[model samples]
Target chain A: IPVLALGIGSPTWAVEAAHERGSLIVSLVGAPAHAESAIRAGADLLVAQGTDAGGHTGPIGTFSLVPQVVDVAAGRPVLAAGGVATGRHLAAALALGAEGVWMGTAFLASVDARPSGSVLDKLLAAGPGDTVVSRSDSGKTLRMLRSAWSDEWEAPEAPTPLSMPYQDILIGDLLGQILRHEVAPLVHEAAGQGVAHLTAQEPVAEIMGRLVREADQVLADLGTTRSASPASIRPAT
Target chain B: IPVLALGIGSPTWAVEAAHERGSLIVSLVGAPAHAESAIRAGADLLVAQGTDAGGHTGPIGTFSLVPQVVDVAAGRPVLAAGGVATGRHLAAALALGAEGVWMGTAFLASVDARPSGSVLDKLLAAGPGDTVVSRSDSGKTLRMLRSAWSDEWEAPEAPTPLSMPYQDILIGDLLGQILRHEVAPLVHEAAGQGVAHLTAQEPVAEIMGRLVREADQVLADLGTTRSASPASIRPAT
Candidate 1:
């Protein structure tokens, strides 16, 4: 419960500081170098994040990044993040040598998500192609459902988005206002391409239970029995 | 033996032609729409190609794309492509509801790859970050090991590369000359982000064997047994 999961983009100081305190630290990585660095920096677990992730994601895909990170981890636990939504994804992550999965987009439309109603509505109606990765929102590569405003920012002649805090600061107030007003076309909420498939929002427990149920069904369908401890995930199913 | 798996970015003619001959058409798709379209166009199987794949790829990641494609396919076999380098990756794909996997970058290091010495050397020494995806090579988004030529073309202010056939035609002669002359900085060989995990080059049989062997181990480790026909993959083991 005291564990901390930090995005790889976050400063290394946070990872190191968490490790020094004897609390388990999970570092999300995009490339193999980061995975190795996280392990060396004393991360308890590494999450290989693909570009499909909603928040600040890297150029590499989860399918590609996870195995690379796992190999470099040298047996350290590595979880696959980004594009993680269903139980089958958990099975895939484990097959790819991930200890688990880390996801954010699945919860974006949840009952508790603070995004405005219009933003949630747009997310539910969008397809995979509806999402785009751009720095216009946060100065870093963040994936979100495409809006008229987001599309303009990616136009060939559009101004290059400012980097980091500058861009975030510049757009922060405007973005907040857009969300507050429930302007869907002008709203940009962090989401992955998987946002295309997830249409409904339900209780967190239901989502978690469904993921476990689907994963168990997938495992059974594949004729693969559970090899790891079921105590952790069984109760949910 | 009657199955043909064509990379999807190519026009539909090849796929249509193959399907007409009563062969199983497995067209690679990078997006969910492509998956649905392929199935409608008579493709027997769909390979969801992610951006991490070598050669031409799309924006979505395999973890995100595969499940989406699977959902659309309903019951059609959906294979995962791009970033598929090892058995664990294969297992992950299957877990994600892929019937199988499609791979090519893993073989780039093989003796049969036929790239120039400089390209091979670069590939061997490269990491995930060492490569890039750009249309500079053939005017389409192809992932390859980054070289001086590719980097310059990708610069923010660089002129956009031409589209398809024309771009390919323009670069064809230049690429041939660069490779023939053993130019190091000008080299650009199609590779995936998983290129970092595969370093050595051997025979096709060795690579294939390792892939199957590793896959079986992963399956077994997961407390699962092979549910599908193992004859073909088992032989490699």
Candidate 2:
């Protein structure tokens, strides 16, 4: 199995441990600099997760981050993540030079994911504009569906979210309470901007089939279409 | 001239005025709701400007925003904006259903743009990570090269930036003085995340030619490449 390491800090110990077991080390990154550090830590593959991702993301957007990480990945395969929910997004990721895509939010609503009732409801109703990135949940910046919980934290009288473990510890009890009690207005979940596209909870197999089929058609059309010509797109520049 | 209406608010008056003069109306939107409103107001064309843009951008990223806006723009042509500086970006925009792209930051460093000395220096040196969106400049969120001005405004002691027009008038004198004095540390310019690709100040013609050539090659290769197959990209799901 390939051990996936979080891309935020040095993962020397995890890399060494994975190597000891003869397993490949996959690392996540949000920037070119992070890609460099992951490579230095002996990561075999890279996942460039942009700010459009659901939880604990960096500032770079997927469109710009993929190419930059690919340029510095030293031939390692780079997977694009964040705001990726459709075949068009897959095609765009390939166009941006990513070897593949690492989707999170798309699968979150899948039946296999088994999301909580409140989380599933919010995910189905949310659009791209309905989500916000805030430190209110995890102390670290997290992109999540907006709810009364977020609003309360964003209030002028609210205290600043503490860093990392402290914030997690402080809110641990309240988070459990809200979830167990099913506090309708306070219930929320991490989601990407692509939440706009996930309107149903389907099986993983169907979602995969649809995505692959759509991407194949899009790629095929793009190759032969006159609209892809430089002449037709000249107005862009 | 086609009147371009800001999509943040209702543009009924601008639409009526443009119609009166027999001019087509173009509108800039950052979300699907804005696209609907712009279309309702009779926009002839739509430009989706995402959070990755330089000045006064909304929260949506270009990748997610383009397709969403396209879905609601009726039959009007939709142009993608923000984080669009290269041919690859142009291809991605098309994949996302945009008719073309409306780029801003790429040209900021071009010889034809004639950016001021301080602005040019900062633009050429800035990478994607070097920019931060802040309300310090125009009292509206603007992505710009991080500078002493932004740092000062972000400090705990600093007062909150007022809304537009009023904030513009308030800081008008200081902004003039800073520019006139050429304060090296405080000098900054509005730029997008794509600034990483603009390392030199070249002619606009060269930039345009390169972008077209690169995009043409990418699209052409994509048509026949084995890498575009669904089997090759199955890991994406």
Each prediction's number of clashing residue pairs:
2, 0
Residue pair clashes in candidate 2: none
lDDT of 2 by residue, A1-237 (tens): 445556566588878776777766778888899899988887877999888888878888887788889889867788889899888888888887777889889999899999889889989999888888889888999999999989889998999999988998999899989998889899988888999999999999998899888888878877776463433211111
> Which residue segments of model 1 deviate by more than 4 Å?
A8-22, A224-237, B2-5, B8-20, B224-237
User: Candidate 1 residues A1-237, lDDT tens each?
Assistant: 467777744456776676566567777888887877776666777788888888788888888888888889887777788889899998888888877788788888888775567877887898888888888888988887888878899887899999988998998899888878877678778888778767787777888999988887876765543233322111000
List of chain A TM-scores, every candidate: 0.89, 0.93
Where is model 2 more than 4 Å wrong at Cα?
A227-237, B1-10, B226-237
What lDDT score belongs to each candidate, Candidate 1 first?
Answer: 0.79, 0.83
- Among all windows of 10 consecutive residues in model 2 chain A, the one with the lowest summed lDDT is A228-237
Clashing pairs in 1: A224-B224, A225-B223
Q: Best lDDT goes to which candidate?
A: 2
Error of 2 at B210 (Å): 0.8
